[model samples]
Target: MRRYGPALLLVLVGAAILRISAFSALYLRYVQAGLRPYLIVSGAALVLLGIAMAVVRRSADDAHDDDGDPLDHEHGHAHHGPRVAWLLTLPALALLLFPPPALGSYSAEREAAQRAAQGVGVFPALPAGDPVELGVGEFSSRAIYDSGRSLKGRTVRMTGFVTHGDDGTWYVTRLLVSCCAADAGTSKAEIRGADALPADTWITVTGTWHPKGKLGTDAAWPPVLDATSVERVEQPADPYEKR
Candidate 1:
């Protein structure tokens, strides 16, 4: 049985990878799409390794059984290690049972003081359109520091989960990730006349950006949106914004 220990771990780990990547957006919540292929390959490799280990163990057992020595059974040629190795499966099981959700309002609140340092390039010119669709992170980033003040006249649309502040303020918040959730940063904009939606509810607010104070200030500064309309919306498949 001890020989099977490595096999058990491989199978469990592999199953966990496949389980999460196959059906759930678990990978997306933590990492980017480029990792999905690697995850699948790793899972398949682990399962194959486990199966190979089991086959070798069975062959060894059969070889031992073929020996004419009856004492072979009592001699205990098998080495089934301690049960503690089973703990490895807990994470896999949890990934299956609970499936952790993406960072939400609580996370945004905790990171309120930290804003995205200058994102990828000069904020790209708003693509030609009325009520341009914009990511929460982009809106927040530009609002705070873009010298051009691009959002001033644009009727922009941003989608994210709602969050309530300690001061009874509402914000549309989204996390920005350079690579994965491990490196996640937060972006947010204060909302006015939000229709008082419950916190953590997903919504798309279409409106215009109005300057509050100086752009690009300290943590106290945030992009403000005077929402012309607020409505509950479904959560998008990929929720995080790429910074």
Candidate 2:
């Protein structure tokens, strides 16, 4: 434990900083209301645990002896003195200072390729509604598997950031990531009558699924959703899907 004292201290400080940042209203509200308390408590616990571990390890190390045996001497030195483990926190600290933007062009292309190969027939049909919340990741995966068969001719309402095109049309897109934004895939349905769409504006769209064209290069996966109406909406604090 003493060998990892610096690492433990770094962990404690990192946890504290992250928690404080998250607790700030502007940042907290942008993430999600439901998750705020959980994050706060968990972060606090992590900080406290790290501190306690470091202290206990230091205390134990102070009571140990410097033996002449090579292995013992090495172990004692490694555990009883300052170590390099704390360096592991550098990248994390950098990230906290400069959070990356949402997954963009690269993710979009990857998602398009994935949809192309798998197809979009399996997506569940959207029930008729003025504002239905559709999970972008779920919908994309289902479409790839089932080709939007379940969503045939049904209207769906979805909310997401707007991605604009040069042709005056805009898409309400969300990234479906496997782990983080770095590996996320993008998915979107067309929004007609959305000529005035604003980039990055969280909006709710109501539309019906219409088999218009093929998804990607494959004729097997067909396009779905022709939006009837679009309205800007608030961004959820926790933007990521729960599952």
Q: TM-score winner among the candidates? A: 1
Give the TM-score (vs. native) of candidate 1.
0.89
Error of 2 at 32 (Å): 13
State model 1's lDDT.
0.80
Q: Candidates' lDDT values, in order?
A: 0.80, 0.57
| Candidate 1 per-residue lDDT over residues 62-105, each given as its tens digit | 87788857788546574567778777778867876777888888
Residue lDDT tens for model 2, 113-216 = 34525433444455665355676554444443554466555556777777766676666777654443444556766566546565777877777655544443
Lowest summed lDDT across 10 adjacent residues in model 1 is found at: 114-123
For model 1, what is the alpha-carbon lDDT of residue 198? 87
Q: Candidate 2: list runs displaced more than 4 Å.
A: 1-9, 12-112, 119-132, 137-153, 166-168, 214-224
List TM-scores for all candidates, in order.
Answer: 0.89, 0.57
